[model samples]
Target: EDLWVEIQANTFKNWVNEHLRESGMQVTDFHDDFCDGTYLCALVEGLQKRPLKPSWNKRPANQHHYLENATTALNAIEADGVKLVNIGNVDIVNGNVKLIL
Candidate 1:
């Protein structure tokens, strides 16, 4: 089970790196990288190939800002027809790797 999780995590990390290559961003640790939501926003933008909602917190200093960014990313994802279930901004901010993936 742990190996399976690790494989999935690595696959996601590589996928994120692939999309974010031109942006000079990389995902080493899912928990820490996506915790602040900034990296997640970048990932979403890279995937969508466009700018996300302008409401994103470019500099998230507190939990509220982090949640805002995560919300924006999740909203964009849903707008792109991705159905997210059992996860929310708090889950992303809290570094829930399983749910975040």
Candidate 2:
């Protein structure tokens, strides 16, 4: 039942600003008015049947490229003899979280 820290909408804006600062990515602002109204969404997925499998070091997403990345990572995780859970839907195994979503 390990869930990610659900960052407040306003605070999350500041978080990325601070973290991505050294990454050289121009993270403008995380405010609604500034971002044209966008919120954070985290997709939690793991082994559905077995559930004991460990997820990829990378994270998952519900969006386009990220979703594709999730699929690839999941496939590799599965092939590694681990189980899986849903990324968006409820996970019946391994536990997951959708924080700040």
Candidate 3:
């Protein structure tokens, strides 16, 4: 179970990196304050369940809006025939990571 969690986390990290690259965004440390494994996992899971469709015409200006835009953009690319492995629940209990893939 422990090993599986690590594998899933790494896979999620790689997925994020790939999307960031495709979107022409700089790759940042996943452990950085801006984002982390748990957050990425959650975001990807949300995306898988219901992909975001952002209005490109009404460009967002704030940080919160920017994040939403980014998510939408990534989802758009994925919608272009890129099949991403579905990621489900990502929970941390008693300092142990639990992942559903």
Measured by TM-score, the strongest candidate is 1
Cα-based TM-score, every candidate: 0.94, 0.28, 0.31
Encode model 2's per-residue lDDT on 1-101: one tens digit a residue.
22333344435546645544443443333322111111111112222323222333233333443434444444554676866543421221212223212
lDDT of 2: 0.34
What does candidate 2 score on TM?
0.28
lDDT of 2 at 75: 58
Q: Residue-wise lDDT of candidate 3 within 7-95, one digit each (tens)? A: 77678667766654533443333334122233443354344554345443233445454355444544554776765454211221112
Off by over 4 Å in 3: 23-101
RMSD of each: 1.0, 11.6, 8.5
lDDT of each: 0.89, 0.34, 0.42
lDDT of 2 at 50: 36
Poorest lDDT segment (10 consecutive residues) of candidate 3: 87-96
Top candidate, metric lDDT: 1
